[model samples]
Target: MDSKAEQQLASIANISNQKERTTSYLALLSTLFSSQPPSKDALITLGRHFVTSMSMAMVVGRRVLGSYVIALCAGTSMDTTGTASITLDDEGSGENQQFMQAGINAFKSSEGEEVRRDVVEGVLAGGNLSGWCEEQTTVLRHLYAHLLQLEEDWLGAAKALMQIPLEGGSRLISDEEKLAVYIKIVRLLLECGEWGQAQTYFSRASLLIHVTKDKETNLSYKLSQARLFDFSARFNEAAQKYHEVSFDSAIAEEDRLQMLKAAVTTSILAPAGPQRSRILATLNRDDRVHSSLPPSLSTMLRKMLLEYIVRQEEVKEFEAGLEDHQRATVEGGGTVLERAVREHNVGACGKVYDNISFEALGNILNLDAENAENTARRMIEQCRLRAWIDQPLHLLYFESRSSHDTDAEAQGTAGGLGIENKEKEVEPRLWSERWDDRIRETSIKVEALAEQIQQKGLIPPIPA
Candidate 1:
C-alpha cells in the first residue's frame, strides 16, 4: 500500500475495536490509491464501505473513522461530478449515467436510501479538520460542505464552504459561487427563525461578498441587509430594503413581488401615517399590483394588504379575497380578517374618534366590546397600534402620535389619518437622510478604490 493508505490505516487502528472500521477504510483507500483505473464499481463500493464504517463507528462512538472517510472521499470526490448530478431520473443514456444507474441499482438491492442518508449525515457530523493536513483540509471541507448540504444542515453547510482555502482547488470556487450558496443557506436559517446561528453566517457572507463588485453579488448583499432588518424588527428600514429589492431588475419578478409585498406588509406595521403613507405612496405607484399579469397568491395578498392599509375602510374587500390559511397568518394568532378589522378600527379611531368607550369602539370595528378591548390591548402591547386601553371606563384613548419616533420621516403626515408633525427630527430617518447615506457610502467606495490604486503604485498617492 502507498504511504497515504498506510497513514490512513494507522490513524484508525488506534481505536479500541478497529477491525470493522479498519477493514472498510483499508478496502476503500486501497482502491482509491491503487494504480488500476478508477472504476465505477470501486467508487460505489467505497460509498458502501463508508456507510459500513460509519454505522459501526457510530455504534462504538468512534466517529473519528468518518473523518478519515471524508479525507478519502476528498481525494476521490466519488468522481461524483462525473456521475452524481445525473440521477437515474434523467433521460440521458450516457456511459457515466448508465454506470451511475448501475451503481444505484447495486446499492438499492443491498442498503436502502435511508441507510445512505444516515451515512452521509454521520460523515458530516464527524468530518472536523482537527488533524487533517493542509491540502486535505481544503478538500475535506469541500466534501464536508456537500455532505452537510445533502443533510439540509444549512448552518454547517455555510461554515464548511467558507473553510475551503482560497489557494487550493477550493479557491477555484469563486466568490460568486461560494457567496451565493452561503447566502442561500443562511437565508434558509433566517426564514426558519434560527437567528443565533444564522446571524453569524449572514455577517460572514455580507463582509466577504461586499468587497466583490458584481451586480448579482451586490443584490445578494442587499438581500442579506434586508433580511437583517426584517428579522430584527426594524420595520421601516426592512421595508425600505425590501422595496429596493422589489425594483431591482437583476432579481426575478416573482421574487421581487414577494419582496415588495414583504416591504408593504412590514411598512403597515411601522408607525402609522407618514411612514405608512410613504410606503403606501410607493406601493400605490407600483402598478404591478393592478397589472394584467397573472396574479400569484402572494401578489394578490400583497395587493389586498396594500389596499386595506391605504383605504383603511375596506375590511370586507380585503377579507373577501383571503383563503383560510392566508387569513390565519395574522400576528397574535388571530385571523387576517380579524386583524384587518382591528386595524380598520385603529385607523378610524385615530382619524374619527379621539377617545371612545370600548363598547362603541368594538361596534365600529364589528367586534363585541370586551373582545375589542382585549384585541386593542394585545395590539397595544405588540406596538401595532398607538393606543391605551382604560380598564375602568372600558375605553381606548387613541394615541395622538406613535409614542416613539425612531424613523425621522415617520413623524409627519398631511392627511387626517392622525397627527401631522412636519418637523424632521435628527434622530429619525427620512428618504432625504437615506439619500445622504447613499452618497456617503459611494464616497467611501471611491476613496477605497483610489487607495487601492495608490497602494499598487498605479497612480501618485493623494495628499492628506
Candidate 2:
C-alpha cells in the first residue's frame, strides 16, 4: 500500500477495537492505489466503500472512525459535471422530456455542486454541440439557492453545492446570490417558528459557502436562533447557542456586542422557575455564563446574576417567613409561643435596621410619617442585612423649601432662613415593593459577577 494509505490504516488501527475495520479499509485503499491514474470506476468504488464504512462506524458509536471515513469520502473523486447546465431543444419530443428528467435526477442525487459543475463544464468544454448550456445554468443556480433555503434539506443542499462546478465547471455567482438563498430559507423557517431547523441550515450554509462566511450572517443566524428558542421557552438551549455565536473568535467585536445584548435581553425574559435554574446550571457547567465579556458588559452581567441569586433567596426567605407566621397565627391562637414568635420576627426586623450606615431609611420614614413610617422602619433593618446595599447608593434625594424660606421670599428677604429645607429621599426600599423588580435587579448583578469570573477563567464557549 502507498504511504498515505498505510498512514490512514495505522491511524484507524490505533483507535480502540477497530482492527478489523481498519484492515478492510486498508485492503480497499490498496486496490484503488494499484490503479495508476485511477479510473473513474475505481474512484467511485472507493467512495462507496468509505461512505458505507463511515455509516457503520456512526451506528457503532465510533465517531472517531466515522470522522476518518468521512475524510476518505471527501477526498474521493466523482463525475465533476454530472448535472450539465445544458438544455437540448427538441420540437415537443419525448427525448427532450427524458433529457430534462435526467438532468433533474442528476441535480437531486449529485453529492456536491462543485463536482457536478466540473462534470458539466467538462462536457460543455468538450466542443459538443448536443447540449443546451445557458438554460440549464440559470435553472441550476436558482434550484441551488432554493434548495439551500429549505431547513430540512440543508445538508442535501450543501452536498449539492460542493458538487457544482465553479468557474469553468459551474458559474461563480455573486455573494448576494448565495446570501439571498440563505435569507429566503431562514425567513421561511423563522415565520414558521422552526428556529432550530433554520439554524441547522444556516450553519451548514455558512460552512459550505464562502460568501456566507461573514459577521452579519453568523450574528443574524445565532440571534435568530436565540430568539426562536427564547420564544419557545427553551432558555438553557437558547442561552448556550447565544454564547456560542456571540463570543466566537470569528465574530467581530461589534457583532459580539450585539450578540451580548441579545443574550442579556433573552436571559431577562427567561421564565424564572425551572427554566432559569436549568439555564444557570448549564451556564455554570459550560463556564460560558461567567467568562470574559466586554469589560462594561462583564460587569453588568455579573451584577445581574448575583442580584438574581440574592433576590431568589430573599423570596424564599420571605415565603418561608410568611408560611411560619400563618402557621403560628392559626395554631397558637394567642398562646405564649405565638406571641414569642411574633416578637422574635419583629425584633429580627429591628436588628436588620441597626446594621445600615445610611440615614436614608430614617429619611423615608420621616417623609411618609403617617402611613409608611412603621413599614419603612422595618424595611430599613431588612435592607441592611438582606438588601445588599453595601455598595455606594446612587439614589436621588428631593428636598422641599421650608415655610420660613417661602415667607422670607415673599418679604423680599435675601438672607437665609434659620431652619434648613428637607429633601425627599427616594431610598430603595430593599425589603418591600414589587417582588419581581427586586428579584430581577438582584439577579442582574449576580449574573454580571458570574460573567466576570467566567472570562477570567479563560474558558471556551460550549459546543452545540
Candidate 3:
C-alpha cells in the first residue's frame, strides 16, 4: 500500500466505536478515488486491509457497517482498475478467505443484493479461485450462475456451475445435491447445443442417478440421456429412452405426447436394422401412434414397419421436425435422415425383389446406381439386410427367407453380409460328391435316350 493508504488503514484500525471507524473508512476511500484512482497493487492492498478491519468491526456487533465496508472496497477497486483481483501471500490467505466470506454473508442481507452482486461479479471475474475457501467458492459460483442464467447465457451459466467443486469441498455435498447440479449442468449445456460437453456431465450424473430417490432428478436424468443420444446420432437408443420417459406419470400429458412424438421421429430416423425394425414394430403396435401422434408420423411408421418404400414428400415432412444435429451430414455425403431412408428403402427392396439391376435400384431409391449399390453393400455388410451383390452383373440378389427367419436373422450376430456365419467353422463341399451326383444324372439321361432309340428301332442289333 502507498504511504497515505497505510496511514489511513492504521488510523481507522484504532477507532474505538465500530460505526465511527466505518464511517471514517468509507470517507477516506471516497476521497482517494475522488480524482486520481489508486494503482492496482495499492487498491488490492487497501482491499485486504479493508476486509480485515471491517470483519473485526463486525466482531463487535457492527454487521451493517461491515457489509457496507465490504461493498465499498469491492466497488472502489472495480471502478479504479476495471478489475478487483487481489493476490495474497501464504501468510495473508486467511485475510483473503475472510474477504470472500464477508462478501457472501453481506449478500444474504435484505438490502445488500445489488452491491454484493457487484462484489461477486468482480471477484469471480478476476480473482484467483485458489484463494477462496471451498464453501465460499461454491456459494459465490452458485450466485454468479443464477445471475448468468437470468441473462439467458446458458453456456456461461453451465461453465459457472461446472466450477462448483462437487467433490471434496468443505461443504458436505449430498448425492442428491450432486445429481441435481450435474443434471442442471447437462440441461444448460444441451440448451446451447453443446452435446459433446453435456455428455461428460451426464455420465457423471448417471453414476449417481440410481443412488438417489428424487423423482425430479430421475426424470431430468432420463430426459437428458435421451437428448444426448439423439444428438450423438444413436437414434435407436434415443428413441427407446424417449419412449420410456414419455410414460412417466409426473410429466404432463402435452409433454408426454411431445416425447412420444420424438420417439416416433427418432425411431424412423434410426439406421434401418433389426434393432430399429423391432422398435418400429413396437411403435406401430402401440395404439398411441394412431391416437396420440399426427397422421403423417403414423403413416410413415406403418410404411417403414411393413418394409414399404417411403415417399419423398413423407420424408420432407419428417425432416422439418428434426433437430440440427439430426439434419447434419454424416461421414458419407448426405443428412442422417437421408441415409436412414435410403437404407430402409434398400431393406424394402429385399422384400419385393429376388434380384434387381443396380440402375433400377438406384432409380427406385432416387440415387445413382453406384450410390444405391454402396448403400445396399453397407446394410448387407452390417447384417441388417440379407442380400448379396453380383458385382459382375451389377445386380443385387436378395436372400429370401420367411418373415420369421428374417426377423431372427436381423436379430442374429452382426458377423458378415447376413449370408454366412464367418465366425463358425464350416465343412468344405467335396469335389468327389459333386462328381458322383453329376455322373448319376448323366447315366439316367443316357438310359432314357437308349430306350427312346430302341422304341423307334433306330439302333440295329449291334449288342446281340
- lDDT value, candidate 3, whole model: 0.70
Task: Please report the TM-score between candidate 2 and the true structure.
Answer: 0.25
Worst 10-residue lDDT window, candidate 3: 75-84
RMSD in Å for model 1 = 21.2
Best model number under TM-score? 3
Candidate number with the higher TM-score (1 or 2): 1
lDDT of each: 0.52, 0.41, 0.70
Candidate 3 per-residue C-alpha lDDT over 96-213 given as tens digits, one digit per residue, 9 for 90 to 100: 4454444444334454444444445655565444422444445456656666776688999899888877787555677777877888899999999999999999989888888877
RMSD of 3: 9.8
Encode model 2's per-residue lDDT on 54-92: one tens digit a residue: 234432222222222222223223222223223222321
Candidate 1 lDDT, 1-464, residue by residue in tens: 13544455446546566556545554554444332233333333333333334234432222333333332343222323201111111222232332333334433433333343343344334443332233333444555566556667766766665554443542244565556656755765664456566677777676578556778667867887787776665666887899888889887778887787676655644444345545555554567745722344235334433333333344444445432333445555455545644664565566556788877876766678877787777766655566665576777777565545433234243442444555432233354765586599999999999889888999875689
TM-score of each: 0.51, 0.25, 0.69
| Alpha-carbon shift of residue 237 in model 3 (angstroms) | 0.4
Candidate 3: segments with Cα more than 4 A from true spot: 1-119, 129-133, 403-464
Return the lDDT, model 2, position 391: 27
Choose the strongest candidate by lDDT. Answer: 3
Off by over 4 Å in 2: 1-184, 187-227, 273-304, 307-464
